[model samples]
Target: MRVLILGGTREARDLAAALVDEPGVTVTTSLAGRVRDPALPAGETVIGGFGGVAGLRAFLRARGIEAVVDATHPFAATMSAHAVAACAPPGHGDDPAGALAGDPAGPGSVPLLQLTRPGWTPGPGDDWHRARDLPAAADRARALCPPGRGVFVTTGRRQLAPFATDRDRHYLIRAVDPPTDVLPPRHTVVLDRGPYTVDGETRLLRAHDVRVLVTKDSGGALTVAKLDAARTLGLPVVMVDRPAATGPVPPTWPDVAGVLAALRGLAAGGQAAPPA
Candidate 1:
């Protein structure tokens, strides 16, 4: 059985690792190549985008990929959309006239699964201002922090452009990669990755004199320390909500173990048990 895992997260890596030793199964993981140097996962790996929906359908048909598991970030809506389209039944896919046409009639019977972590929920002592998108989050951040007050931004490099509109407020932006576009005049960029500790995050908040925390609700242990620190410091958080899923909604699992069990069932030519 051949499987293509659209992976980047730790859960994706874990799933890939679990599948590596399984007999009669071949695994290939694909990365979006957003980060400069991402940690390699087990089995074969392909970096960069698969173009668009048309390109993806072509690749899936050519590669004989039997199953597709989308383990991309929650914010990667575009890629998720393309993946769903690429795995849909024959003429029902996004590209009806493309390379998928060469396949047997009613092709793309592959099982499509999405492995997404749950988003964080606000708890006691958390001053959460939820925004539907990044732009709204920036506006909330601006409102929460007056001029001269700093805002700690952990919303990634690409989304930083919206916050740049507030030139007067200071921003302490942290990202894995450096921003390509020009930042606001009062912004300081910290090129860093996370698995951050509460103590480290506390010190960072203190050093920046941040009054507000701006971040996406990208749920995981690695970046949750910042939220804990914000709660500790009594700072308001402008949390940007994840985008709605596009195309067909596939079965989703919140953790790697669930995904592994499902994949194993699929590889054995059995229907995957519904998520618990």
Candidate 2:
């Protein structure tokens, strides 16, 4: 069976690793090319965009892809929607979500699966400040401290340019690698990897006297340690809400383990190809 895996994180790697040895199963992991020096997966790997749903559909048909599993970052809404649209019967004319409107094939189409980690919930003693968008988050973060407040910006490199737009403000940005293109000035760049711990995050927050924190709701425990630290330090956290996913909302696995279980079910011919 041929499987295409949309990947950009370690969880994707883990899933690829688990499936690498499966007999008669060929796994290809597609990266979003947002990260620098991403953790490579085993087996076939493809980087860059799929040119949206149409391009993805063509690729799937050309590749003879039998099944698709979307293991992208929870925040990667566009690609997720594209995956569903491509797999669904062409041009049913309905909204991106699985309405009867689109489906050119009428009913039968390829199987699509989603692997999503659980989102973070605030606990007691958590000083959570919610922002509707990234720009708002940056504005709030800047307003919290005039200068030298040791701001921590973890909103990923994509939105960093906006925060940096406020040149008068100084920020301590944390990303896996230094941002390539446009970025805000007056910032200290910290090049390190994530999946940090609460203890480690707390230490970093306290050490920097971080008065304000900014990050996206990217869900999963590995990156949520800073949220806890923000709560502990009584620091104001400017959180960007996750974007709404467009298209059919497939069965969402709680984690990689659940994904494995689903894969097993599919492997048994019990799930992958649902009867027409």
Once model 2 is optimally superposed onto the true structure by TM-score, how far is the C-alpha of residue 216 displaced, in angstroms?
Answer: 0.7
Task: Point out where model 2 deviates above 4 Å.
Answer: 93-108, 165-168, 272-276
Local distance difference test, per candidate?
0.83, 0.75
Please give the RMSD to the true structure for each candidate, in Å: 3.4, 3.6
Q: For residues 1-276, could you state the per-residue lDDT of candidate 2 as single tens digits?
A: 788899987778888998888877889999988776888999899999989888888898889876678899888888888887787766642443342112124443556778777667778877677887887887788888767567888866666666767766567788887766467777777778877888999988777667888888888767878887788778877778888755458767666777766666666775632211
For model 1, residues 122-211, the per-residue Cα lDDT tens digits are 999999999999878888888889899899988888857887777788899898899876677898899998799999999999998999
What C-alpha root-mean-square deviation, in Å, does candidate 1 show against the real structure?
3.4
Residue 261 of model 1: what lDDT? 85
Report the lDDT of model 2 for residue 262: 64
Among all windows of 10 consecutive residues in model 1, the one with the lowest summed lDDT is: 96-105
Candidate 2 clash pair list: 89-104, 92-101, 92-102, 164-184
Candidates in order, TM-scores: namely 0.93, 0.86
